[model samples]
Target chain A: MRDPGNSGHPDQSGHGQRGSIEALQEHVDALEHQSKTTKRAHQEAMRRERQLRTHNAVLAQLSMNALREGCDEHVARREIVTAAADALNVSRVGIWLFGDDGQTLRAVELFDRQGGFARCQTVIRADRYPRYFEALRENRTLPAHDVHRDSRTKELLHDYLEPCGITSMLDAPVRIGGKLVGVICHEHIGPQREWTLDEQTFAGSMGDFVSLSLQMGKRNEMEAAIKRQREYLRQIIDISPNLVFVLDEETRFVLANKALCDLVSVPHQELIGNSAMNLIKDQEQARRLRKMDEAILRQSQLSIDCEESFTDRDGKQRWFHLIKRPITSVDGSGKQVLGVASDVTERKLYQEHLASMVRELDHRVKNNLFAVMIMAEHTAMGSNDIDEYLHAFNGRMRSMAIGHEILAKTNWQGAMLVEVINSLIRPYVGENLRHVTLDGPDVMLPARVAPAMCMMIHELITNAMQHGALSLEEGRVDVLWKVEDQTLHMNWIEHGTQDVAQFPQRGFGMELIERTAAHQLRGDAQLSFEPPGLRCELNIPLKLPADRHE
Target chain B: MRMAINAQLKDKLKDLRVLVVEDEFLAAKSLETSLRKMGCEVVGPASTVDEALAFIKSRTIDAAILDINLSPGTSEPVARALRYRNCPFVFITGYSNISVLPDDLRGCLILTKPTDPVSLAAAVGQLAEHART
Candidate 1:
């Protein structure tokens, strides 16, 4: 309309042109507003992209720190859980392990938002969280945008996460050697949040670190256990009382305890490389021991009650009861002989000493019985009265008892000659005729010789008292003996007898004296009557039976 | 008849020479008398190792009778000499156990005392016959 007529051209044209220009201006303003909006949206997108990259870089740095501190499995798991919780902005983080039976997942570690860990208070049984256990057992990641939405996971989520104010959850399983060991879970509250692929990948990597650290920790525990067991066995073997030794197949000593060193009277360092037979006292015995060792090697085990005399460091003989057995190695590939020995020297000596004592006791009892027999026979021959026989028997037994007492003092070997003479002659000595004299060389006779000599001396003393010099107030007697060329010559001279007379017949006393001095001792005797008293002389062989001599 | 008996004794004594090894004087004298009565000639009554060794070197003995134990120990030297000469011998011992006998003398003729005259004569005759064979 404004451009329709030319008459109103100036006014209409200006007004129309103003209107058109204003319209153009408004269009231009709308186009500029649209371009500015597009530019600002692009700038905001670039800023958000840079922020996400920084978060990813921080997560990578945290994961590297967790791996670097993996010396301790517990500390590494805690660091990983805490780092994951902070990255995801969650309230709590936990690591749960699937039980070996595959029915349960138990919490291994737990971390709160404040970076503090609760150990015993935060364990979750898998029965209460079936979905979580299934995901871990299947070795699959579980992403729950709204934990309360899934009926299968609602109660479990509530039981495991509600107390800790968790509403959304992200979980990844940790695997080692192709087996599902545990899971790493991050819990968030209030609303569901989108989980990015990068965040899920980062969580999985942290799970791998936890797996390797746990495996290493278990291996270290096993090694420590083995070390403790070895030390215990070594202590037991070192403190054993008996002489325990181990020898190689070549008969060389390989191991010996302190007791073995003390037994051989050598240091442990000196005994190790030496042959076992070197401890034997005799060379011939050593040869036999070598044969025994050979036999033991051929046959896997051998037990022998060997009488071996071992020479100590000072060359003293010690006896042992050695027990050796072959020890097969655990794998049955190697063989060693284990030898144990016990000292038996004292027991052997005691047995020998006891045997000697028994033989001596038997000899003494027989001699005493023989003396009683002689006394009974002589008394019966001298007088017919029973009273006289009893008195004489009593006196003879008393004298025999005295001899036995002296023998006991000398261990039944022999009695001293002077002691016997003094005891036998003491009863007959008087103030005026106290001239009982004894002269002889010192002689140690056997048990057999001492008793025979005692009886002989007793008879001579009795005869001197009843019928010879001791019958008078001024009587005297001299007893003397000397050993020459293995012959004992004894003389008994008596003085102050009433008269010297030749015996018409052999009386019981004379027969007793002659038989005892000759037959019992294997000697000779000669008795003669002199002017003042009676003289008796006897010769006896001094050598005894060979067995009884030593 | 007496002369005939004497002739028989002479015949028994003709080649019977013996060596007696004993340490005890009484026992040796008794053995000598018994050997003479049996019509055997006794060559020696050697008491020790040296005397027995000398007698063996000097004389020819048909048979030997030895006491197992001499002064020191078992009469091993005399036994060894008798074996060397291949002479027949018998061991007279006071002990019944034979473990102490020399290894070579084991299972040989061993007579225990106190020996009777008849057994002694028989043993000597048997040993002599074995030697002759």
Candidate 2:
């Protein structure tokens, strides 16, 4: 029984050894197949890593170039989108930014690999792309592995990407100061692909580059706006005609416009930091200005016609009419005084001159009235008959009245000699000047001399009417005057009335003419009774003292 | 003449004392004769501010006739005194321009110069009326 069992065991042992060797060979073959699969996957990952590194380098170069060219945010965004698309080997790239109203995402840049880039459409219609909008609001990257799987993204991807042949998409949010400003995305149109971690990281870097460009662009725009506003204000201040000045709360000159500097004859630099009162020559005016400044400090508006006299840089006194106003801060908590001044020196002087003229005119009129009264009394005393006295008085008054009319026309300074002579001789020109000869230099006589000359001329004419040139139709009276060495020589000659008396007794008319021409004027007169008639000549200086002449 | 008889019988207005403030010599002399003929005693015909003021203080004046404008300026002093003493006075001026007339004396009688005997007599008569009142 022992010999038969041993022979069965040897065959079983040999079969079991052969089975174990075959199973080990099968296990080794399976492990070799898995090793080949793992090596292929690792090589594919390394190839993707190198591609991403190259894409990142290209993106960095594009960003640096865009910045050096001073590209604005829109241009910089477009450049970054195109570079990212080329690096990722994609067909389209786009950048969408949050609008002022934070709920919407507006497309800012769009690039296509085959054709030129198109301007970003203003209407991305964020409401229609719910999944994409949620991704942006959450500030998370959304890489779609299969566009057809997610129902929320399927409609947008199918409608927007299917026609363009796009299958995969990668989107990353651009953050600034921990806030999502926009998103950068790349779309692949050739084949359905999954986004690797490297592609996502590159997209994130692009988002960062866009955020920096936008911030810089906004800062530049703000600075330019501020500069333009300052230049406009400076132009207005320089070209204004009225003097403009700004004073601090301490009453010191903070700024003076060009007009104000020219007005005060001081340089703008000299005026700044100086006490405003230093320009004022009059102490009283300075005190008033200080009070006005105090009022401004209290935030009260003041308007006054202030007469200020200033000593200019040349030490010349100039008068100005100052109008001060207060400029208050927006909240009315602080105030600065603004003053505008206009020169009124000439106007004030003209007013003074006019007033003095009026005073002098009044005095002349009173003196003339006195002369009229005296003449009336003397004429009345001279005549025996009432009719003769009345006639003489009326005639003299008429002549005096004519003088008044002339004085009135000239504001009582004087009358033109030609005007006075013409007025006096107008009534008698046909009757007397036709036969009489009148000649004189063109001269202006003072108001005082006019009355006396008028009276004398009347008396001479009356005498000729009664007994000289006017007495005979062929008779003539020659009157002339000349300015010789500043002396006025007046001649009255009568060359008629041969049969008239050689000389009549001195009468009131003769007395008046003599007294007025000689005593009053401090001049000399000669009266001769020639065979023809009576001749008279008078000589006087051109300028006379007021009392002597008046 | 009636004027001569009036001048001789000066006793009627001998006690009627009057103050005369005038600047001109000729005008003042004529006024003095006219007043004397009307039988009034002339207190003075002062020529200046000081003289007029001194005469006003020294005299017992019943009435006064003042020239509105003296040589230097106006007769404001005489007007003020006459107003203080409650005395009546008439203003005499050569011209009708009386802008310089004192505010207090605006209501007083104004006599134009080279006045006739009748006007002088009437102005004096009015002063007598004021005195009686």
Candidate whose DockQ is highest: 1
> Which of the CAPRI classes, incorrect, acceptable, medium or high, describes model 2?
incorrect
Taking the tens digit of each residue's C-alpha lDDT, what string does model 1 give over A245-358? 877777888778888888777898899988877776588987887777667777644665566668777777778888877776435776767777778888888897887667
| Predicted structure with the largest TM-score when compared to the true one | 2
lDDT of 1 at A276: 78
Q: Residues A58-117, candidate 2: write the lDDT tens digits.
A: 876976775654467667777787788878778888887888876666777878888858
* TM-score, cand. 1: 0.51
Model 2 C-alpha RMSD vs. true structure (Å) is 10.5
